[model samples]
Target: MAKSMSLLWGAGSPPCRRVMIVLEEKKLQGCKHKLLSFEKGEHKSQEVLDINPRGQFRRGVPSFKHGDLVVNESYAACFYLESQFKSQGNKLVPDSPAEQALMYQRMFEGLTLYEKLKAVIGYTWFVPEEERHDSALKRNKEALATELRLWEVLLVTFFPTVATLFRFGLSAERYPQLGGYNALLKDRPSIKASWPPHWLENLKGQDNLKDI
Candidate 1:
């Protein structure tokens, strides 16, 4: 019999979203998805702890389970999926050594950018207004702005090669190239299908994360 995989995840998490994108890209036929709730503290529940005793939930949402094998962390899970399920749909990790290296580099940068973005989101939105640190929020926003500008610069010089790095939300005025790239990624079937439902509801009127 073919192996079955279980995926545990929280909604609206970028790491979870990343893994979902990979899962959709690979079109895993026997995977089961379980959505966790932050409001209900589902991540800290005994069920999750039973599957992953020492897993770092902060690092990623979607944890993968295939029989006795378990993988946590979005990057590790995505890479594992790409490596193990190659005979199916989209190839995420690339073939050539040079191309693979480039893809890895972009993925690494994108992950770093997401970390900063998460910090910004945490301070500005997730955290209670009374509990949020103004200084930390300011610093995180500044750092994110710097990284975004760097990506914009890269987009100008290496549009074709680095375009995939700008696959998420972006500002049109500050990052015209990345904005176009974001549109392309948003249009992707996998990305569209796996997009955070809550984000779509909340961000409907917003153009960018500049003010947030």
Candidate 2:
């Protein structure tokens, strides 16, 4: 039997885009999908909320498949898809215990940690502008930068190849860490497959964050 996926999603949300990228990388073509649009404020409809596990009383969980495995979360979905195929193609996360540990560390830093920082700065002040406090925004900004520095450190520690580092502009003199990490991740065909969907490119110049 063929497996299918429902990509519960909205416009320009990085997490949703990340999941789409992983699906493409896995080449899990047999799955079906439900493309939920944000323009219509569909994520908030009770139907979407009920399926999401994140207490996401607001949005539904997007899922993907390859045969029998139904997966969720951009990170877990990628890991499961790759693990199921056991393909010799580019590996997204290394199989080695030591390297896998490092990969998880960096991946989580980018995924989970970043979400917290964004939440502190944006979600915490999610109220209308009339209620937003400059003091809180300032505090959030400081916290966000501090959390980002953690990623800078992880990049250099993980990626060692110079050729791979060029994409993120991490010259040897500046951000050596991130440059190196980019090099490490750059060669993986699987990771490349996970690049944000073409639709995400629509976010190129929109400075203000929109509800997705």
Candidate 3:
């Protein structure tokens, strides 16, 4: 079954890397996969669109396929893999009900985190320079600061690898704990094995949230 699975993903995309990390953690490295290029718009190619019709309109890497089943959403792909291959690798879903509930809550909250972070910095990447405004950027930074306050507890969570992408903009002086946690996550075997090829080639990344 692992041999029959195939994943289409972009190396630099955090969501795509999240799926890769899950696959590694689940001992599904035998699954065939291809790395698409966002710079070249390979994610919108006909091959991807065939499995993920929404790819035509949305940015859609991290698409997973198992036999006849296709999973388009990154979070769904990770959960499906965890559920289907529960006994194959390291346990992900907690055995206790309370722990499971907390894990699920954190898992879903990841979407809100991504949304808030994107609002603060996505414009510089996706929006045209002419369309970007200082006023909107200010509002986004304020909203993100508020969101960060709510997540001030210890950093153990479902998507640590995905969250590490934000480290580029996060100041170590301002977020010392998160900086240490980010370093630890990057050293994890799954994260290191699935590290983006492009990122390795270019060690530096854009600092879009230096002000935040």
Candidate 4:
């Protein structure tokens, strides 16, 4: 079953890592994958564009293909995997409706958190130097801080799958609960196995949020 799956992903991307974690948890290790380079704009290459047209707008990668089914969104692809292969390895989705609803909410909220995070750290990289402003960067950091606080409060309710925040300079000292949660998650077999390959090469990550 895994043989029919193909993934186009960037190792440094959290979204791509999420799908990779799910795949590992589900024992779908045989799925073919193309590791793209974001630095080289490989995510926007013709190979990715063939599967996800949005690649033209920098909205690609982490694309999953299962037989004829193609899912471009990271979270949706994860849901599809959990729903279709519930009997395989680990059970990700809950049996009760209430728990499932909470999971869905957290999943979507995670997307929002990722966007806010990118807004802060990616501002200088994504925006043109001529158009960049200190005020805009300050606003982005404030938004990300607010989002992080929300997640910190709910940290105990779910596993810490969004460790990207820490990599980008979210101080574990400020959010002790989240820091502990992330530490526990780091030891999980799936998470450890799916950790970004590039990150393994560089133990120290970027500190874009040192002041946040």
lDDT of 2 by residue, 81-119 (tens): 577665633456677999888777766666554454455
Worst 10 residues of 2 by lDDT: 159-168
Q: 2 or 3: which has the higher lDDT?
A: 3
lDDT winner: 4
Full-model lDDT for every candidate: 0.67, 0.50, 0.77, 0.83
Estimate candidate 1's alpha-carbon lDDT, on a 0 to 1 scale. Answer: 0.67
- TM per candidate comes to 0.79, 0.63, 0.91, 0.93
Put down candidate 3 lDDT per residue, 97-148, tens digits, no spaces: 9999888888877778777777775767767899988998898888876766
| Evaluation by TM-score, superior candidate among 3 and 4 | 4
Clash pairs for candidate 1:
none
lDDT of 2 at 192: 53
The candidate maximizing TM-score is: 4
For each of the candidates, the C-alpha root-mean-square deviation to the true structure, in angstroms, is 4.5, 6.5, 2.0, 1.8
Q: Which has the higher TM-score value, candidate number 1 or candidate number 4?
A: 4
